[model samples]
Target: MAGRVAAVDCGTNSIRLLIADLVDGRLVEVDRRMTIVRLGQGVDASGAFAPEALERVFAAASDFAAVIRAAGVGRMRFVATSAARDVSNREVFRNGIEERVGIRPEIISGEEEAELSFRGATTSLDLPAPYLVTDIGGGSTELVLGDAGGVIAAESLDIGSVRLTERHVTTDPTSAVELAAITRDIDVLLDKTRVPLDEARAVVAVAGTATTVAAVALNLPEYDRDAVHRARLTADQLRDTTTWLTTSTRAARAAVHSIHPGRVDVIGAGALILQRLVDRLSVDSVLVSEHDILDGVALSLG
Candidate 1:
């Protein structure tokens, strides 16, 4: 059997929509898009979704509704992570989305998010056993370890781009004091995560942060998903990129060809998180994967 399906992933920094045709168990991509709505803005400080943040996400959801309807998707799954899970006024956020998209968003747990991310990211790669998939988002980072059998261990930490930026970054490129604070926060979370970082044979970095880092590491003129997918980013490459990002001004970072304008403010923190993971794991490089939780959500529809 075959069907058209849509998967929506709403995170703190952005909201993405993926529409695909599942033909006899294979997924064929039809449409993929993302909007930077900053939905998690102020959530870390306020413990609730800000009114403007809610509006931005609602607007994005409305646009996704149009895309879904036009694509004639038979089934759709909408998920909200990190920020949605922490907000106290989540019902308000849910109502707006349900009214616009006609589907109530599931605020999934960190463990479930890790599993979905693992399935979406690693199923097609011919990598070694016991792959470590790290998805760094705006509000949290998911670390999942698994092989062909399934997920072995998973953990989600509060260290993320947007959260880190809000918590520690105040200067344009992030002062040394800010960077050190962010590093401490990440180290604490890493210590709490149960997975053995040194044991994994390979690391697969997914989501916007990793992809963007790859695009820069490759020195691509612009964002290219095909080129970045499965691209190897060496420890030196990551360290160099982190140094460039952390020392660059906001305007300078935004000027980078592949750096998204929305991400410029928080990418310094994001890069640091990724860099620390690489150093802690002692891996030579990380293989970037564009397919992540969105793909996993689509597969779950079947």
Candidate 2:
């Protein structure tokens, strides 16, 4: 069945939309875009969606709705993760999206989130099986161990860039105490993760955090999706980049052409999470994927 479909991934830090044509059991991209709304802003401490945050997300939803309509998408799925699951005022966020997009957003579980990430990331990769897929989002990080057949074990941890930054970051360049606090939290979550990291034959990292890191690693004068996507980055490269990001001032990070302004404040935390995972897995290199849960949701529409 050939059809035009759209998938909207409203995560903690950004809202992304993907409109694609489903033909012969594969997705052909029609449009793909992202907007940094920081929907999870203050949700960790406040335990509810902030009024300003809801407004930003609603505005993005309106824009995405227009795009979907323009593309004439026949089917669309909106999935909300992390912050949506933690917030008490979810109805406000949900009703706002439904009003603009004409479809209710599904607040998916962490396990399901991991599965979708794995599917979207591995579908186009010609890599070794038993691959470990990691999605470092704003509110949470999902670790999924799977192969060509399917997923084996997966876990979604609460340690994310926005969450960690909100909890333990105050200095300009981030003090040693702040970094240690963040690292400790990440280590604690990774320690409890049940997804056998040792079983992975290859590692594939997905979403904004991984791709942005890849862009810096490649030393791109600007953000280039083609160069970042599917690019292999060694462990040493990741470590050095992480070190530089965590130690650099906000002005220096903002000056980088590869780092998005929305991510400039928290990329260090995101990079640290990636670096810690790489060290834990002891992998020589990791393959970065631009296609992620958005692709997974689009595929599910078929």
Best by lDDT: 2
Judge candidate 2 against the unseen true structure and give its global Cα lDDT, from 0 to 1: 0.94
By TM-score, the best candidate is 2
Task: Write candidate 2's Cα lDDT for 1-302 as tens digits.
Answer: 79999999999999999999999879999999999999999999999999999999999999999989999899989999999999999999999999999999999999999999989988967778788999999999999998888899999999899999999999999999999999999999898888888877889999999999999989999999999989999999999999999999999999999999999999999999999998987579999999899999999998
TM-scores of the models, in the given order? 0.98, 0.99
Kindly list the per-residue Cα lDDT of model 1 for residues 133-244, writing each as its tens digit.
9999999999999999999999999889999999887787678888889999999889778988878889999999999988888899999999999899889999999899
**Model 2 bad stretches (over 4 Å):** none
Task: Give lDDT: candidate 2, residue 278.
Answer: 89
lDDT of 1 at 69: 99
Q: Distance (Å) between predicted and true CA of 281, model 2?
A: 1.3
